[model samples]
Target: MGVFSFDDEFTANVAPARLFKAFVLDADNLFPKIAPQAAKSAETVEGNGGPGTVKKLTFPDGKYVKQKLDAVDLDNLSYSHSLIEGDVLSAELEKISHQTKFVASPDGGAIIKVNTKFYTIGDAPINEEKAKEGKEKAVGLFKLVEGYLVANPDAYN
Candidate 1:
């Protein structure tokens, strides 16, 4: 098992609550609309859109990943989730964990942070390579969310 983590921070002019609502709460609807290249679509599986909810994201290559909400803190704008199941990368990944948090900066903007952990068996062909792939995907996601907030100032009401 290999452990890997990636962290990224983005300063968005949008409010924290607004950014959270669009990126985390309404991801099923908003992500596809903004980042069609990366996330073709998302569907809510278990719950509505809160803690314990399950969501599956479909990529363009016909592969999908399912995530189970582990924790949610609306006060701090943070949440954690683990990979329940997926064919994200060659079907060898057994477990993956990710957490996202939001902080309201003193400058009246919001900072978004993401961390990821991946685990695999012995000597997989793309162990570290897969981790790098995940980092790139995260960058793409941030760009899409940032672009959306930039375009729609009134999105999170």
Candidate 2:
């Protein structure tokens, strides 16, 4: 097995707490409502949405993903999860994990950091194009939510 990892960072005009609230804490409710092109719906399948909680996201193509929460730190404005089942993993990947952190910037905004790890099966190397595509999707989602909060300042406040 080979593990390929990467990290990405983005800045937003929204505060960490508000972004965190809308992005992490209330994602199941806020996500599908805004990202119809990505996911048709989202729901908690098990646990109380804390550590070990499993969240299922059904995509518009009728495919779905099941991710288990590894950690949720409200005070620190961070969360971690792994794609345990569904689309990606059942393909060429052995596992995929993600960690997201949000910190306050000097400009009263938020700086978001994302770390991703892709485990490939056997000697199969991680596909760079697919990895880049995944990163693009992640950034797109972040920007989508950021745009939503920017359009409605009262949201997640």
Candidate 3:
């Protein structure tokens, strides 16, 4: 098996606490409502909205992914999850884990840092293009939430 990792950071004009509440905590409810074209819904399949919870995200095309929440720290504005099962994982990928951190910036916004680790099957090397695509999707979601918060200043406050 081969293991690969990628790190990415994006700055958003939203507070860390608010962003965490909207994007990390309430995403299952807010995402689909705000960007229905990208995600049909996100629902908790097992456990509550906490660590060890299983959440499934369904796309508009009917494809879905199941993720197991590993950790959540509202105080630190960080969360981690592992992809337990999903159509998003190709045949070459055996597992994928993600960690995200939202740090408060001096400007009252936040800096979102994401770390993704990909484990490949057998001798198959990790696909950089696919990894990049995943990162782009995350960025897109963040932007969508940021835009929503910008439009409604009182939201997630």
Using TM-score as the measure, which candidate wins? 3
Q: Is candidate 2 or candidate 3 better by lDDT?
A: 3
Best by lDDT: 3
lDDT (0 to 1) per candidate: 0.78, 0.89, 0.91
Model 2, 47-85: lDDT tens per residue?
987799998999999999899999988889999999989
Model 3 Cα lDDT, one tens digit per residue, 45-148: 99987798998999999999999999998779999999979998989988799999999889999999999999889988987887888888889989999999
lDDT of 2 at 40: 90
lDDT of 3 at 1: 92
By TM-score rank, best first, the candidates go: 3, 2, 1
Report the alpha-carbon TM-score of model 1 versus the true structure.
0.83
lDDT of candidate 3 at residue 47, scale 0 to 100:
95
Instruction: State the displacement of the C-alpha of residue 98, model 3, in Å, after optimal TM-score superposition.
Output: 0.9
Q: What TM-score does candidate 2 reach?
A: 0.94
**Residue 22 lDDT in model 3?**
97
- Clash number for model 2? 0
Worst 10 residues of 1 by lDDT: 119-128
